[model samples]
Target: MKLRRFFCLFLSVACLGGIAQAQDDAASLQEVAQRREAQLADALERLRTLRNDIEAQQIPLAQRLQDLDAQIRERQREVERRQRIRDNQSVELDTLRQRVSDRQRELDYISRTLLPEYFANYDASLSAGERATAGEDVRQYNLFLEKPDTSETDRLQHSLALLRDSWAQLESRLGGKRYAGEALDPEGRVISGRFVQTGPLLYFAADQGELAGLAEETTALNATVTPLSTSQNAHIVEVAQAGRGTLPVDPSLGNALAIEQTRDSLTEHLEKGGIWVYPILLFALAATLVAILKIFQVYRIRHPQPMAIHDIVKALRAGQRDEAMRLARSQPEPAREMLVAAVEHSDESVEMVEEVMYESMLSTQPRLERFLNVIAVTASAAPLLGLLGTVTGIIKTFRLMTVFGAGDPKPLISGISEALITTELGLVLAIPALVLHAMLSRKVAGVMARLEKASVAFLNGLSRKSLNQKAS
Candidate 1:
């Protein structure tokens, strides 16, 4: 039994020691778990701090990326805007080039064609200095056309200057003025003289009585100066010296001067009409005078006193023979003579009275017909005289042609002018003379008709009075 108790005590001691060791092991494990919990808390706090730092860093980086993206989009838009500006600028440059080319072409045409043509027909009335200047301008214009270095603006400015200068020069020349110049005389000699210009009409007169008229040239450079006739020279010289003389003005400016230079004067033309014109003029004058006298005489005879015929008839019907005779005597000659013869033979028969009145009427008819034959003879003879003159002129023309062999036409023209003038004058005289003769004849016939009517009425009155006297 003693041995069994000792083993139990030893087992109990071993159990107590094992229980204490287990308790100690549990306390160490709890302490190790607390240390691991603190380490884990520290690690988690470090992770949170790291996450906050990363988030703060991520905000700046994201803003940087957004800024980069915005910059890239701006760069693309800027490229597109620059391209559009370049396109617009290219179109504008092309338009400017085309305008420059068109302007250049216009300038070339003016230089080549227009300027040369203007110089070709330059006014002949211009002075030598003005013409020289114009010629130089034309040469310069030609040079400008040939030169390639000249700009369009420079060429256009030059052309405008040339046109302005040409116009001013023309205006200065058109206004007429007096000047000193050399003129050509009839002998083809040059004479220094004073020149007078009225528009295009120019005249030159020297101190030595050398006078000439100038003619403009259309193609040549110098004008032709023609010497005038002696009388015309005197007149022109007087006008040039006195400055107030009746010069022969050309109504058509230069045209009349040109025509007059080729034709004869009026005085020379009239002298060529021959001596027959004088005879024609005399015939016309005489015929005119005779016609006027006959017309006056017939007019007087036709229109007598209005109351004389009625008074005579009433007095005779009332048996107042003396009063009736006095009234009849106051009438025109034709009626007076017939009434006087009837009154003187009042006691005679009607047939005797009628025979006496008819004798008086025949006698008065010759007076009324006086000078009519003369007018008729003049009208008939004027044309015959003109015909004779024409025949003589033609004969003279043929004689001149025979002598000159038809080579010189001057004498032929003179003879022809004379012949034509004589015929024209004859016709002019004959036409009026014929008209006057016809009028005078009609007037004389009317007077005779009135005389016959008065005579028949007087005869009837006489017959009635005589029959009443017999019946009573």
Candidate 2:
């Protein structure tokens, strides 16, 4: 029994030892499991923290990307706006170019239309009438063919005055009956005798075989139903009063022929009417064209920028001498030249600067006066030329009278009318041109004076600056 008990105890101790070892192993495993679980929890926490960080970073990155997209859209809009502006500007530029081209074409057409060729036919017609009328009147007969501007009417009127003043001169020249004495009534009745200082009073025999008185009586009798009546008398008067060659008719032409020629010439003048209007229209066109050209040139020079003296002055006062010079060189004028002079003498004495400015003014004076004398001459000559044309017309009419006996007064009257019309046209052209020339000249002088004043002031201001610097 003792042996048995001892064996059992050994077994129990072995079993207990095994159980304790197992328990210890289980405790070690449990500890290892707890540590692994804590490590996993830590890993999970780290994963969650990384996820939160990523999400936060994503929000900022997304926001940044959205901002970038908005910026890109904004840039596109800006580009579009700029493009639209450029497109609009291009369209406007094209439209302006087209308008300019059309205007140029219109101007060219107008210029061609207004040329003298178009009106030459009309002038020829008027000239024909003028040629027919100049012959009958004594005044008309005297005119020279070389100069037609002095009309038959003008000559007649002049000669009539002359004849009235000195009847002896007409009788000696014209071979007309000299009535030193005697006067007749319009009814073929003798009114009185003209007192002759040297001899018996001369009387004119009337168509009724009655003696007509001279002087007033002869004039009164001749005033009506006389072959050489009012027109003839007028012609005689004109021839007597005027310069010798200026008379349209030959005083030598019989009194009847003179009167008849005057009437015929007047009739012919009416038929040809176009001559007077065409020249006037053409001249006006030419003047207008010249004015337009001048205006165009002025507009061309004045556009984009204006030459402002005030701006130049500002530049000068600022001591920006180079800028001032550049500005002055932009235009050719008294003001620019004076400004340049002042800038050149920036350091000079005030008096010296003033003298320099004065020199500039004198230099520009001739330029201001340029073409003004020509304009004045043209103004004076236009009317004279018109008068000459009228005289020529009259001469032509008188020449016709010599060729064709005065059957009708129409041509002669027409010629006289044309001469008068030409004279009037000349005055019309000359007066306005002269006035415009004077006005333009005055304006140029005024502008030049202003330039001089401005220049003086600028120089004074510059010299003052120098003086101040010296004082300093």
- Pick by lDDT: which candidate is best? 1
- Model 2 misplacement above 4 A: 1-320, 323-334, 402-407
RMSD of each: 12.8, 46.2
Predicted candidate 2: what Cα RMSD to the true structure? 46.2
Tens-digit lDDT track of model 1 for 1-472: 9999999999999999999999999999999999999999999999999999999999999999999999998998998899888988899889889889987787678765776566556533354323435566766776875698987677668777877887865665466445566555555565667666665566667756555554343334434466556777677777777765645556686676678766867666546668887888788888888888888888788433445655665677688989888877777677788888877776678899889988998898888888787778778887887887798789889988998868878769877877887887788788888888999899888888887788777777667777777899
lDDT of 2 by residue, 271-381 (tens): 343365455546655654544443343323221123355566567767787887888777455466676787787656778878887887788777656555655665777
Per-candidate TM equals 0.56, 0.35
Residue 121 shift from truth in candidate 1, angstroms? 4.3
Which 10-residue span in candidate 2 carries the lowest summed lDDT?
Answer: 194-203
TM-score for candidate 2:
0.35
Off by over 4 Å in 1: 1-77, 124-168, 174-179, 184-190, 196-286, 300-332, 340-348, 351-431
